[model samples]
Target: MKYYPQLTKRQAVSALEEFLAERAPALERFRQALRADGRDPDTLLDGTTQGLVPLWGWVLSGLTGPDAPACTDPATVPHEDWPSWERFTAETEAILSYESVQLLDGFISYLVRVVEDRTPTAQWQIGQHPNKRYQFRNHPVLAGADRQIFFPGPVASSAREVVRGRRAPANDEMAGYAQAVIEALSAEETRHEPPEPLVEVEDLGDHPIRGREIEVSLREDIAHEYSRQVDHMVKTLAMEDGITRVIREDREVLLVATPSWNTTQLQEWVTQALRDAGNDHS
Candidate 1:
């Protein structure tokens, strides 16, 4: 409802084209180096026509910037193990799950700076379309909230494939800002309208416990305590009657079917669980 001076969709798309064109030589060099390594650039399988751009972005700063992390202590780190800037790419977590996120995010970070430099007033964010269930952890569009821009990129498809494996909870704060973002992204990649938030319910029609027995079961389960994440989630989800917490394998776990659970609630619940577990005895 207020006027903004940052990039519009058309301008953002044009800017991406310009950025890619300027880096065309660098991109070509990248492909050639990959080919020489016997790694076919065509089959990079980054789930984009752009080919290996994610990897290139992951190592872009090291290859081109003064801030490369490879400038480590020479005696402690072997020269042979140091990153070869000439190659234009280096390894990180090579799996798609990590690739679509860290690798693509690195590239997106580069793009954001480029966008910022060009449009001084611009602010950008890279994240999922919460309304999207078949979504990736990192979608290709760089959202410029100030000017209703979604600077789309090759990062979308492959990232989606990775996200399809494990769905994360939607962020309410993000949703408050991103409804228009999905509209500007490719139709195939986003929902036309935001979907109503849904929660999972278990029938428990013929299960072993019911009525007062359920409350007794819950009280028995609560005796074995967990940690901060538990305290945090209990404070968060204690009023959601549809949910149940139980100890499994000596650990606190929620008993609802994952797909049917409140994605946000379960996400907060389990994330803390994992964090608590990982910190256990450490």
Candidate 2:
């Protein structure tokens, strides 16, 4: 999707209000249809309703493009010319069976997206070693699950300076201070230690253990060495179609299977482990 020009929070909010107002008549008609059909109008319009997608899409279409209104006073913008109420009602009546909550949810989700797109990703600077200009830009963290706008390539001391100067800087001023601190820290040539590696176990086999309970205990001496292996085995059992709960305490692991799990498979896995361990020792 083409990135729309960024808007300040206030502007974005005003634009959303205007967009909603343009669609108010049709949305109200949709609500009336729900009430007439013996559905609670208020209860039906929530985040999970499916009918809101097309409506949100229509709203977005108007907000994008070169001819799109500038982020000025909404009152000054010409009102969108909507289709007559009779025509709109006839078209929307076919989909009145869908829940209203999902439709509202779609609008909310799109609004959030529009606002975030305008949010500055980062602020930083440019220059030579000592007198560099500060800047800011968006950097991805948490595997892109989250993003923060701050000075790129900042050192520990500089980061500390940035943090110390402002416990929480205003949005507009954050970029410069963050970049300045990062540059100062970089000049100090601070050293950083590598992060610790994460240890995780993966499932090795599939079985239906959804609701069955089982416990296994390991000797303390071998717990560290075999914890990963044990964890993998437990996960395999837990993932079985009906397994519901898995609990671990020190060297012991417990599992609970729901009706969907196959207890026989659990038994077989345990027996196989015993045989494998015996063979290894022998």
Candidate 3:
């Protein structure tokens, strides 16, 4: 391979601006869909991590340059000629899913080693679903028949928790942590490795759905909420998966390593108190 002259930082920046310009209309369409759905812009659950917007802004501006529409007015761009919203959304989800898997793979490998004596090993293959969900499955660290770890939430939440030693907030507290993670990652010179290019799978004529179909199901309300989450899971997959893995691994590590009888005794009493409360309520 012949070496080409490296572009200066300024030239690279100029090229990025042009790219964002072309995607301006697509971004506007996304913003409109969010507004039409009455979604809160501040909701971290939506995959809008702290520095994500700024980063996207940088991306758009860098790619599209001055030719791109003003960032303030997503409405200025018309949606008539825009791509199908569903397709755009699916692609966005695919991008999220693809990135999440790689991050989870590296982060979990390091974390599990930190908490356990065994060396990390290859356990899962990363892949994307048609719905654009990502997974790192078939890992021994997960302790299952398949030993898989699935990340089904937003990348920001997962990244923040892993890099910052925190978990996603249930309410309003520590809301900025997600943003902090994005900013921190954005400031870093090295970018996370991009996922391998997506591959197309062909449907075979003999293929059939083979899983056992269960007659029983959850109540209507429960099912509806579950469906809603499934519909929106591209946003929350990473964080949810990471938090779960950390808690389980942390508990196991603590049990094995914490040798203080006094501390264990106090924890046992606390556990008994909580169990007693549960029994009394029942």
Candidate 4:
């Protein structure tokens, strides 16, 4: 048995739709912006950009609308709250400015991570354990048994003859036949010509590199830097507030307060301390 993150395809799709629904107002604003710019309403809605339209359509098709029949499956998402595709498209387009693409990319990347986390990498099967095994005898010939005693009677005439033979050759005559076989194999090998090398292609400008490449692990580095910043902020708070230690678990930051200092008081103190530090930095 192997441990894996648990997520279903339906669950993933529903989550994405919910995300879009929550951002519906922002999407409406995007549509307004596009209309103000004198662009066609369907410019970004027709599923042209980055193949998002198909994904949107799939999500739309799967949703259970209010007028639609009730679904017993927990994974079947309700579309009562989801914005129409027209609004979603405008919102998606509005969010696609040069720098804003990173946000959309991040959302898609996170969804992929969620799916991968739920998938199993290893499989389970029933079989004998590797430590438990039984011994078996090897073939007599393979085990180096004497050829004369173990040989299956004499070879039949049809089996022994490569070229038509009047009868099976005697053991003493086999040497001449073996020599002839070797000569025939050598001649066949000599007749095969080696393949020629591929010709080099000309350097045409058909495929051009569009943008300058920078070497950096963007996602990993950003995550690491964010963690470092958060850790430093917590450490600063601990020093200023006379806290002993700070613990981090996933997205949570914890500080154990003394009996006299309640969690609410501690939270306020930390919040104020962060604000004061920000002011000082400014």
Q: Per-prediction TM-score, please? A: 0.24, 0.20, 0.18, 0.19
Cα lDDT of model 4 overall? 0.29
Q: What is the lDDT of residue 109 in candidate 1?
A: 38
* lDDT of residue 183 for candidate 4: 36
lDDT of 1 by residue, 209-237 (tens): 52210111111123254445455545445
Candidate 3 vs. true structure, TM-score = 0.18
lDDT of each: 0.34, 0.34, 0.28, 0.29
Which candidate should be chosen as best, given TM-score against the real structure?
1
Candidate 4 residue pairs in backbone clash: 5-118
Q: Candidate 2: what lDDT?
A: 0.34
Clash count of each predicted structure: 1, 32, 27, 1
lDDT for predicted candidate 1 compared with the true structure? 0.34
lDDT of 4 at 92: 24
lDDT of 2 by residue, 32-118 (tens): 655765766565454222323333333222222222244232223332322221121122222111222223323333322222333
**Model 1: clashing residue pairs?**
200-260
Which 10 successive residues of model 2 have the least lDDT summed?
Answer: 136-145
- Order of the predicted models by TM-score, top scorer first: 1, 2, 4, 3
Which model, 1 or 3, shows the larger lDDT? 1
